[model samples]
Target chain A: MIITSKKAIMFVLSKIEGAVLMAKRGMLIVLSGPSGVGKGTVRKALFEDPEVDFNYSISMTTRNPREGEKNGVDYYFVSKEQFEENIKNGEMLEYAKYVDNYYGTPLNYVNEQLNAGHDVFLEVEVNGALQVRANCPDGVFIFLTPPDIKELRSRLVGRGTDDLEVINKRIQKASKEIRMMQNYDYAIVNDKIKNAVEQIKDIVKSERLKVNRVMPDYLDSLGDEI
Target chain B: MIITSKKAIMFVLSKIEGAVLMAKRGMLIVLSGPSGVGKGTVRKALFEDPEVDFNYSISMTTRNPREGEKNGVDYYFVSKEQFEENIKNGEMLEYAKYVDNYYGTPLNYVNEQLNAGHDVFLEVEVNGALQVRANCPDGVFIFLTPPDIKELRSRLVGRGTDDLEVINKRIQKASKEIRMMQNYDYAIVNDKIKNAVEQIKDIVKSERLKVNRVMPDYLDSLGDEI
Candidate 1:
């Protein structure tokens, strides 16, 4: 009887420990969309909401910091050489170069925060988001889309450029980006920022309740317990 | 210029039509769990919430209508021969015999409601749920679970049954049902009915936003528009 009780206690303890470990592993959420589809605005609004519980992944950049930008807060301002070195060593999760300056998500910081059970949120351009997807295929990828194709085209045309050819080119680019929505798990139309935020919050809540994510730990813990 | 304008109009019309069609196809959601895990209570609470938009699927049963049980509202009470005939004709989505009484979900009603864009909700036993899964694999399957195995055991014991053997049998059966949660898409612990309802509502919201379900119509509509 004592032996059986000891075995039962051990099983319960292991189950509790497994639950703890599972709870401590946080999710990674990547939000990306077409250039003029307001990904940045939605992300900012989401972060400003006190109900949103996520740690924004501060990116590392080789570009000169703008006025009032703080190191390690706004971004981890790094030398071009240091950024290149990190890329060479694969310490960057995803990186892109624009105007001779490199900007990238650091792998180490994301891993650290995830291990500490803090959901890490990344808002990136479509290309950068693709790169992140290649590295972390399991991350929740959300693609934000405009209300409609006409809306997207109108936004491109209204971008303070009366050049017809330039507007056409921007529209084509937006179309390509919209096509990339197929690569994402969920798509939320950015009709209103508040609506988008609420949908995203619900998505996170639903993902957390998914059986695939929550059951493996239980199965492992219940091994031979029954 | 005339041809281009005509083509654009057709494309836009087709896209609008596709969106309308997509919006009209409703989702099928199944809620199931162990026999005594309070699936009925949670489902009741969910339906009582004014925010839930799903239509409760009334089941058909081959049993005498108890006090105040209406024919169509409470259950589609039918003769055993009729129920068996429906099962033989494959008109039943799922059916089971309990206490020598036949109970089943009617496929025609569910399909008609879904075609009309009414999200249909089903609360069934695990076996019946598996049958539904076989017929409608795309349905959202939510498994209700106890907060913990210990809690499950206590619930079984507290059922006013002093027979140890019966209690053990109940526990073992519950374990098997819980293990079957692997076949489900989501698991919401029935710690509190309110909490479960919220989680379920969030899950439906997220499922509605899934790219797999929403983008197919967009892609089909945009076939040559881009």
Candidate 2:
């Protein structure tokens, strides 16, 4: 007996979505870690595992694509002017100025997957991840840590690149990030790749069953809305 | 070196306990639902599943021994005077009077088990469960609900004793409790017993890995406190 506009209907639907178990949006899982902490390795293992259903957010970077790097897939290779325009227009979720280039997560693709009930993963810096938390408070922020700084240092050196100065700088940044780990929702110790991935998987699965995700339709359908 | 009293050391230890995961106190899991919600059946199944490590709390009551009920195992049968004394002494964590008999949970036993690293389960009324929450804020509160109210009604009637009046009273109480499901940390649909048990187990396992539970020793040992 109620008539409403499409927008009003969508508004009501979202409210119902909050209470009901019907098709809900996918979770936003943000992953942040120190340099040389194996974020890339953990992410690769996660992608290879068929059990987890998630899409990695392809970030927009102003830097030129290195050899073998594909545009739009590996990175959303963008012009410095275009990246700045997106920032000026309030499109970038979070952006940072690196050594020379700018890197940021675009708003659209992440939200697109989330709207389709697909979980999205973003490997972000702590500052950018905190910004995403402000923009999307419901997102889960997981801080991935190495077994130890020695391992992180060795891994950085193990890459067989980056001189002593760069390695020390990376180590310093890692220490600062590690101190802020308390602000994150979950911390994963990356001593064992399988264990870390398993912990993250369990966290996601358990999060889906939180009371906030209850479907009001199911409850209302349970014999006269009791 | 700074010298401190045993009391000071205890206080410091408790403070460290909050920050580090040295020897964690076992989790306190509170389970509650309506009369026909199959709480007992589900609990039995969970206990039988050797994968879970938990012990059921023994509640104190003023009622006399009913047939084969053991003194300590079934319920700690106490007189009205003794029960009143414990309540006055603040020993009862939570209690309620039903049919002119007092039923309560003693604080010491549950804490003892938690300190010893054994999870404890307490099945109580919604009111009592909330009281337990106030006392043990860190405890995980799980609300067990039936698939639907009609099933609950049928199950109550299936007991073959409760007349129409009592069944209606119980149903009404359950409806009120269901509306308060928002306060709980988790709401599990009791369609399949195994599935319910599995979900609870997963929640406990995930909780242990929370960022707040990081062991200081592990972090300190991680190659120069980074």
Candidate 3:
């Protein structure tokens, strides 16, 4: 019996040591939502919350940015050649082309922020979120939607930027996106921006307490004691 | 152009109405963790805090009541015949036999608490938690573990109830439980009980603001005429 107790204690000590090592590693949070679901509004509100230190990720784009858009701030505008080079080098987490312009997430800024122990938020399309998940298996993925399909259509049309034809196309695209909601770790319906922001904020704040993210040492210590 | 704007307004209005309906539903939250990870300690702390109005669920069992165990206080002790009847009637969420005695969750009390707009916590085994999840898919699940396996084993052994053999058995069971941590909605490593309690409190506070849980009529008015 004494020997067994000693063995148990030794086993516990080794596990605790491993957990302490893992505590230093960072965790990633990914937010994805359908278009025109006020994801931007929610993000803005979240960033404004003083309690959270969030690192905003600027995307790399080959397209010409609009007026008052800075190279690094608005987007890391690069030449098509540079963009293609980064893609070949696997420096981008995910990339897509739109109207002959390429946009992608550059891995550097995100990694830097995560290493600094600050949570990073990525506002991306559904496809981009999925790609991030594939690359970073540990990332927390949240999918946002309007309360219902009817409301989603109205949000898209209410923007007044799209013509009827464009609006219809968006509605169809949203239908497809809504079906993918189950793939997310959590779903936040954009029925109320304030409420949705609170939900996302809660998810972010709660995620920090995850054993893998903040307490590997804690878990390891839960075993036998040396 | 005017027609396009009008259509958009109508769409937004309807979306808000739908959100209001979904908000009327009560939300469920499930709290689970390994034994001796201080889940009970954290829960008591949360209850003491004014912000948490959570109802604690007392399970029903067929085991004879021990001294000082009052009906509906510690548990609702029922005869084996009554428990079997409950099982036949689908009145229990989950049931299992331990040491030849049956323990199960009664659905009535849980539903009553939930319908009264209170978040009910069923401190049950993983099997029971799973059954609750199956019954209520929208319920949020939280799993707790110790900061390290060593700490957990220490806590278990420190209780002084079990000898080396019993402690070893618990340790083996815990290893299996750790593997199932991924099935949880959130994993909380209990290093400091106060800190862990705060984290869980934050989650409950934030989850209350979910779009589906909070009414959204105000949002529809954002785009409507005064």
Give the Å shift of residue B50 in candidate 2.
1.9
Candidate 2: tens digits of C-alpha lDDT, residues A1-226: 1223334433534554454444468889988877677887888788788998888998899999999999988899999999999999999988898898999999989888898888898988877888998999988888887554445665766675766557668767766666777768788888899988888888887777677765353355344423
Residue B125 error for model 3, in Å?
Answer: 3.8
Q: Which ten residues in a row have the lowest lDDT in candidate 2 chain A?
A: A1-10
The worst-scoring run of ten residues by lDDT in candidate 1 chain A lies at: A153-162
Candidate 2 matches the true fold with a TM-score of 0.74
* Ranked candidates (DockQ, high to low): 1, 2, 3
A122: Cα error in model 2, Å: 2.2
Worst 10 residues of 1 chain B by lDDT: B153-162
Clashing pairs in 2: A19-A216, A20-A215, A20-A216, A21-A215
List each candidate's DockQ score.
0.46, 0.27, 0.26
TM-score of chain B of each: 0.84, 0.73, 0.71
Winner of 2 and 3 under lDDT: 2
What is the descending lDDT order? 1, 2, 3
